[model samples]
Target: MKNILITGASRGIGRATALLAADRGWSVAINYASDAAAARSAAREVEARGSRALTVQGDVTDEAAVAAMFDTALDGLGGLDGVVVNAGVVAPSLPLAEMSLERLQRVFDINVLGSYLTAREAARRMSTDRGGRGGAMVVVSSAAARLGSPNEYVDYAGAKAALDAMTIGLSKELGPRGIRVNAVRPGLIETDIHASGGQPDRAARLGAATPLGRAGSADEVAESIVWLLSDAAAYANGAILDITGGR
Candidate 1:
């Protein structure tokens, strides 16, 4: 069976992607920074779909933890066919000038550095030059990356923007090696992330602003992620897909 590792799989978009991928016959390594209970619950769902599942605990911002997570996943799954760098964070809405250095550091640490660590490890393990099979990587970016959440969370936006650049550059760098790198930019999705940003109802309030006139669900975004990881997207490297309902 094809194996995939997904960071932040305990809930939200990460959880949704794990469940969907498992349903489609992929062995999943569910990675969570904390809340082992939630991670195990996600693993149970994957196993219920008749797929192998492993629950791994690691803080993506910690280089050693990320390396260990990858090692555990590789050993448990036998091999990895894909990785989803989906773990991220956002502080309460605030202007750039008013934002504390610590807040910015925390955001960038998890969203930017964390993604770099996971993607780097995945490349190391999945690259043909490393004597392993090539695989796909799907990064969960945000529409805020392009919109530039002006007064809200510019730090979060900047972090995600960095991820976009990484997706483009890494896709080209790894294409010849048979690895595909892509990103999905989700907008106003109904997830707990907004609550972390101190706006639990942000999605509902902004739903009408989008052309589709509604906020997206975690499952909706998951579908796009799974497709990008599938053979159907064979020629979809370096693509930055928007799941924003035309926002």
Candidate 2:
């Protein structure tokens, strides 16, 4: 069976993707930062879907922890056929001039740095030259990477922008070595992330402005991610797919 590792798989788009992956008969490794209970709960759901499940805990910002996380997944799942780079965070709304140093560091450390570390680990393990079978990687970026999020979250926007660039470069670099790298930029989506960002209703408030006139769901974004990780997208590399509602 195909095996996949998804960071931040306890909830949001990550959880949705895990369920879909299970439906496809792929074994799932659900990675969580500190939510052991939640991760186990997600693991139960994956098992219920008739697919094997594994739960791994690691704070993506810690280098050693990230390595251990992958090692655990590798051991538990046998091998990884795909990886979903989805762990990230954002702070309360603030203009760039008013944002605190701590906020910026936290944003970039968990978002940009964590993403690079996760993708890097996946690359090392999944590269054909590294004694691994070829695989696929789906990075979760944000529409803010382009829209800039303006006065509210320019720091977050900037961090995600870095991911966008990384996804592009890694796709080309890894394609020849075996992995297909692609990214999804999700627009206004309903998730606890907005509440954590101190704007619980951000999606509903801004989604009406999109050409689709509605906010997207985590499931919607998950569909695209799972598809890209499947053979259906075998020819897709260095592709940055936008899940935005035409915002």
Candidate 3:
């Protein structure tokens, strides 16, 4: 069976992806930052789907914590076949000039640096020459990278843009070594992330702008992420698959 490690699996898109992947028969490693209760509940659901699930606790921003999370997953499942680098952070909406350096750094520390650290470790353990099945990685980016989310949180967008670039480069760098890296740029989704950003109305505003006249669901984005890790996307390396409904 395939083993997939998903950061931020306690809620939102990460949780949704874990559910879907488990249903599809993939062993799931559910990583949560602080909500162990939620993580355990999600783990139970994943187990209900007839696939093994392991719950790991660690802050994504810490390299040691990230390494330990993976180590626990590897110990429990023996190996990892794919990973979803989905943990992220957002500060309150503020103009670029008004945003504090500390806030910006907080977002980047978890979103950009954390993603890099996770993918870096995965690459080391998943190298084709190491004698295991090739691995896949899917980063959850945001449409704000292109929309520019002016006056809201451009810094967050910028961080995601960096993630997008990393996904492309990593995909190319690891393709020859039998690894694939890709990203899913999602539009507004009904998740606690907006509330965490101190903008509970974000979904409404984004829905008005979306051509679909509605915000996407966490499940919708998660579906795309799961597909990107599937064998059907073997030829689709270094691609940023947009889940936004036409802008």
Off by over 4 Å in 3: none
Residue pairs with backbone overlap in model 1: none
The TM-scores of all predictions, comma-separated, are 0.99, 0.99, 0.97
| Tens digit of per-residue lDDT, candidate 1, span 1-247 | 5799999999999999999999999999999998999999999999999999999999999999999999999999999999999999999999999999899999999999999999999999999998879989999999999999999999999999999999999999988887999999999999999998999999989987999999999999999999999989999999999999999
Query: Residue-pair clashes per candidate, as listed?
Result: 0, 0, 0
lDDT of 1 at 116: 97
Please report, as a residue range, the 10-residue window in candidate 3 with the lowest summed lDDT: 124-133
In candidate 2, the residue pairs with backbone N, CA or C atoms under 3 Å apart (3 or more residues apart, or in different chains) clash, namely none
Instruction: Give the 10-residue window scoring lowest on summed lDDT in candidate 2.
Output: 238-247
Ranked candidates, highest lDDT first: 1, 2, 3
Question: Considering TM-score, which of the candidate structures 2 and 3 is the better prediction for this target?
Answer: 2
Clashes of 2: 0
